[model samples]
Target: MRTEGDTWDIVSSVGMTALFVAAIRAAETKQPDALVHDEFAALFVAAAGDPDTNRLIDDPELWADSPLGLGFMGLRSKFFDDHFRAATEAGVRQAVILAAGLDARAYRLDWPQGMVVYEIDQPKVLEFKGQVLADAHATPTADRREVAVDLRDNWPAALIEEGFDPARPTVWSAEGLLPYLPGAAQDALFARIDQLSAPGSSLATDTFGSDVDFQQLADFQTEQMRDTSFGKIDIADLLYTDDRSDPAEWLTKQGWTTKAAPPEELAARYDRPLTEVLEPYAQMFNGMKYLTAVKPS
Candidate 1:
C-alpha cells in the first residue's frame, strides 16, 4: 500500500520497480537481436547487489514467466528512443525525463551538440544513479542534470531552479510513470507540462488503456510473478489503478496534436510481433497505446 507522503529508496517499494525495469533492459541488452542496448542497465543492477533481483535477471526459467519481458520492453525502449532521436532531428535541444528511474538515455543516446537532458525523480533514486554511474566512470553524451525531487511535489520550481528554460522547445518523456499517480494528479501533471512547454515542444509516454480492469490486471501480474522474488511486493499495492482520462485524449483536449501507436504496430514495426505473447493479456491491454503529442508553434 501507498501513503500520501510516502518515500522509497533504490530497492524497496516503488524504487524496486525501477530496478525491475533495469533488469529487463539488462536482459534485453544481452540478446543477439536486442532492439535497444542499454549497457548501463546491467551496471545499475550490479550496484544494487540484491540476490533475488540478480537471480531474476540471470535465471532463464524465472525471467521467462515475467510479464512484459525482453521483447515488449525492447520494443518499447526503441519507440521512446526513436522519439528522442526525432526530437533532436527536429532541432529540439533540451529534454526532460520524468520519473527517470534507472534510465540511461543521457549516457547511452548520441545526443546532439549542446543537448541538455534533465532527469527528474526522487532524491535517493537520483543519488543512487549518480553514484553508480560515477563509480562506473560512465560519461554522458549530453549535458545531463538531475532534479532530485518527488513528482507529487512542486517539481516545476525545482526544474526551473536547475536552469530549465521554459522558452525553449523541449522534448519531455513520462515513461512508466502515470500509473503510480492518482487520476487527479495525472491531469495536474499534464497541465504542468503544458504550462511549461514552449511552442514546438513534444512529449511521449506509455499509458494504460481505458478498458483495463485493475483487479484482473493485478491478479494476472501477481500470479505470473508468484514463484519469483518479485511476487513478495505486490505491484498492485503500489499502483493507483483507479480509472483515469486517457493520456492521448487528455492531451488532444489540451490542444496538442497527438498521435497514438498500438503496441501490436510497434512490435511488428520492430519485427517482434507480440500476438502470441499478448494473447493471454489481451483484455488488460485492449486499448493501450504509445502516445506522442506536439505543441504547435
Candidate 2:
C-alpha cells in the first residue's frame, strides 16, 4: 500500500499504472481505426526499464485475456482527448491535469495559441517524464508547467506557486485518479477544484460506480494481471476500494451542469461494440462513468 509520503517514478506502483495505460495507448495507436493516437506513448513505455512492462507493449497476446480492459483504455483515452479539445475550443486557455502521470497530452495535443497546460503530480514522476520527453526532443504544444506535488499535500498552493491562474477559466481533468484516493480524499479533491474554478471553468473525471462489487472485480483483475506478462506487478494493490460519493451527482449539487456516460454508450458512438468475451468485463468497466461538467458562467 502507498503511504502519504511514498514516492514513485514511472516504473513501479502507481507510476506503473501510468506506464500500463501508455502501453495500451501505444497499442491502440497502431490500430487502423484508432480512436486516439499518442505518438509518444510507446517511447515512455520503452523507457520504463521494466522487461515485463516492455514485453506487454510489444506482445499482443499479453493483453489478450483482458480485451475489454484494453478496449476501454482506448475508449477512455479518446474520451478525455475530446474533452480537453472541447475545453480548449470553448476558450478555456488554462488547463490542469490532476495526477498527471505519463500522459503526453501537453506534448501530443494541438493546443490553442497562448494556452497553458499545468501538469500536477509527484516530483519524481514529473521528472522522469520530462527527462524522457527531453531525451526524445519532444516539445509541448502549449506553455506547459509542471507542478510537482502530491495530491494529498497543498497541491493547489504548489500549483499557484507555479503560476496557475485559478481566477481565469480553467479546464481540469482527473483521469484514472479517483480509485487511488480514499473516499475522503476524493471529496476533498473536487472541493479544491471547485474552489479554484472560475466561472465557465469545467471539470472532467472517470470514477468507479458505487453499486459494483469491488471485491469481486478486484479479484478478477488480480487473476487477469497474473496471467499476463505484466503479472508480477499486481495492479489491484494500487487501488483503494473504499466507498466514494458519486462524482456526477456531487458535481450537480455543487451547481455545475454535468453529463455522465458508460463505456458502452461511448463504444457504440465510436462504432466499436464489445465482443462476447468482453461482455462481463464491460459490465465491470462500465461501472466507471466518464463525467464532464461545466461551472455556471
Candidate 3:
C-alpha cells in the first residue's frame, strides 16, 4: 500500500524493486550474448544479503521462471544505454536519471570528458548504493553526484541545490519509474521537468501499453509472488495503475518532438526477444512502450 508521506529504504516497500532489478542485471551480465553489461550489478546484489534474490541469480531454473528476467531487462537497459550514448554523443554533457535505482550507468558507461551524471532517489537508497560501490573500490567514469531525495517531493529544488543548471541542455531518463507514481504525480513530474528543461533538452521513459488490464496484471503477478521468499510484500502494492496521459502525446503538447518505439520494434532492433516471460505476461509486455522526446532548440 502507498501513502502520501511514505518513505522507504532499499530493503523494503518500493525500494526492494531496485534490488530485484539489480539481480536481473546481474543475471544479464553473465549471459554470453548480453545486451548491456554492468559489473557493479552483481556487487550490489551480493552486498544486499538477500538469500532468495541470490538464489534467483544463481539458479538458472528459477531465473527462467521469472516473468521479466534477463532478456527483458537486457533489452530495456540497452534501449536506455543507447539513449544516453546518443544524447552525450550529440554534445549534451548534463544528465539526470530519475528514480535511478541500482543503475550503474555512471560507473560503467564510457562517458565523454566533462560529463556530469546526477542520480536522484531516496536518501537511504543512494546511501546503500554509495556504500556498496565504495566498499568494492569502484570508480565512476563520469562526475557523479547523488541527490538524495524522493521524486514525490520537491526534488527539483534539491537537484538545483546540488548544482543542476536549468539553462543548459539536459538529458533525463525515467526508466521503470512512471508506474510507481500516481497519474496526477506522473503529469506533475514531467511538468516540473518542462519548467526546468532548457530548449533542446531530451527525455526518455517507459510506460504501460494501451491494452494493459492493470488490475488483472497486478492480481496475477501478486498471486505468483505470494509463495516466494519475498513473503507477503510484493511490488504490486507500490504500483499505481490509474489513468494517465501518454508521455509521447503529453510531451508533444508541451512543444517536444516525440518518438515512440513499441516492443516489437525494440525486440527487432536489438535482436533480443523476451524469451523468459510467460505467454500471457509476454502478450501484456508486448504493449509496453519506450518513448524519447526532444525540445526543439
- Please give the lDDT score at residue 70 for candidate 1: 31
**Candidate 1 lDDT by residue in tens digits, 11-92:** 9889998998898888888888899899999899889987777776676567574446637788889999999999999999
Measured by lDDT, the strongest candidate is 1
Position 220, candidate 2: lDDT: 68
List lDDT for all candidates, in order.
Answer: 0.86, 0.82, 0.85
Residues 261-291 of candidate 3 have per-residue lDDT tens digits of 8766788999876555665576567777899
Off by over 4 Å in 2: 67-70, 227-229, 277-283
The candidate with the higher lDDT, 2 or 3, is 3
Q: How many backbone overlaps does candidate 1 show?
A: 0
Is candidate 1 or 2 superior in TM-score?
1
Model 2 TM-score, 2 decimals: 0.94
TM-score of each predicted structure versus truth: 0.95, 0.94, 0.94
Candidate numbers, best lDDT first, in rank order:
1, 3, 2
Instruction: Provide the lowest-lDDT 10-residue window in model 1.
Output: 275-284
